[model samples]
Target: MTDIFGVVADATRRELLQVLLERYLAPESATGDISVGELVEKLGLSQPTVSKHLKVLRDSGLVAVREVGQHRYYRLEPGPLDVVEEWLVPFLSVDSLGGGLEQGEASGAFAAWSGVQMPASLRRAGESLQHPSDAGAAVGRAMADATHGTRHRFEEASEAVERKVFDPIRKKLKKD
Candidate 1:
């Protein structure tokens, strides 16, 4: 089996994965699974070329396949990508800007939503990004901007749910 690094090293493979995601995983118009022909058309590659990339992705367990008659349908397998995310947490921290975060909260909060625990070393790495100095001001401002944006979106989504879902039920119960 090829390692994920090797499988994703090729730009074509990444593009293939994007094609599968955009076509089959789009929440607005997802059709569930995608076939090799569709990938070839979207990727503008030959069947053999597309199939070769799919084989590598399948071997690395990055893509799951369903056999239906003679056609094979492929979908993304997200489990293996968590390893890549773990490796990336340190880099994603504000280490370069000299201020990371407190208590690995960034990765911890993100991972909590995904139901995965952040590793200890990675958590420490995130905490180590916290630096209190003049230079850290820039990083803090950036973090604040991102946090505000995320919080605003979450609040908006919560309000929408309350209005469109819970409010109607509340009104019905009151009527009853």
Candidate 2:
């Protein structure tokens, strides 16, 4: 499946995708949608210029456009992008990457929401991110993992991200 990310490997398209994603993901976005005028204003691009990028995203099936009378509203469709996300899961996943934030809380606020008491080890580590001296060591300890089982899976995932997504973007961008 083609994704906005594929087309958005272009800097211009990335800007448009950022606007759409931010607007769509925002809690107060207009109807959870954005109009072409709003996109132009937010991105500081011309209507036709923004429309051109929108067309690319729409054609790639990464975005959907709905027409209400004369205005068109665009929204992100995660299906095509899921291919990219899934492909990059290894490099981005906490389980695979080994040093990233925990599941469900990208900022690592698992204690409050998970109803699981923060382990003293992690609490100390989290507190350490606040201190300049212990920050580096704290981060290292927070990310330590026993490399018993998941190495091969992460290797395969890393390879996929390099081959399928990163390499393609690099090759495409390097073309004359």
Candidate 3:
């Protein structure tokens, strides 16, 4: 197995990963796959240079390639990132921070904001937000949390309305 750290160590490779991530997050990108020519145009790099970095990424299982006729498309393979995430989780733990934030407080505060259970990795990341020494930072985080909560609630309501109202009406209309 190639060292995942080594595979991601290059600046160009990281840029490539960021590009792939952007495509994955884009609403218009149905497949989240990008062609070599698109990547070359986006990054302003030569095709051979992009291909070289992509080969390294492919070997390390960080990206997957699909061949369509003669052209190839690449998309990010996020599974291999578990190795990095697992390694980093310990460092994000409250214990690792010398008890800066209590686990219960962190979990409770985050749960109240999110209104749902989060994975341990995300909880640990949230724990890092609750430092006792920074009042201003705490206020900032409170505002951000409130904003996120509002957005979450809005999305839930929107989805419910779509399912219970719009979807049924659309179905009825389609039947006629």
Task: State the C-alpha lDDT per candidate.
Answer: 0.70, 0.67, 0.75
Report each candidate's C-alpha RMSD, comma-separated, in the order given.
13.8, 14.8, 14.1
Candidate 1 per-residue lDDT over residues 70-159, each given as its tens digit: 999998886787777556543354232224444544454456676655645445545666565733664467566555555566579868
Order of candidates by lDDT, top first? 3, 1, 2
Error of 2 at 60 (Å): 1.3
Model 1 pairs whose backbones collide: 100-129
Better of 1 and 2 by lDDT: 1
Against the hidden reference, what TM-scores do the models get? 0.54, 0.50, 0.55
Best by TM-score: 3
Model 3 error, position 131 (Å): 31
Q: How accurate is candidate 2 locally (lDDT)?
A: 0.67
Better of 1 and 3 by TM-score: 3
Clashes of each: 1, 0, 0
Residue by residue across 26-88, what tens digits does model 3's lDDT show? 577998999999999989999999999999999999999999999999999989988986554
- Per-residue lDDT tens digits for candidate 2, residues 23-55, read 676575665678999899878889999998889
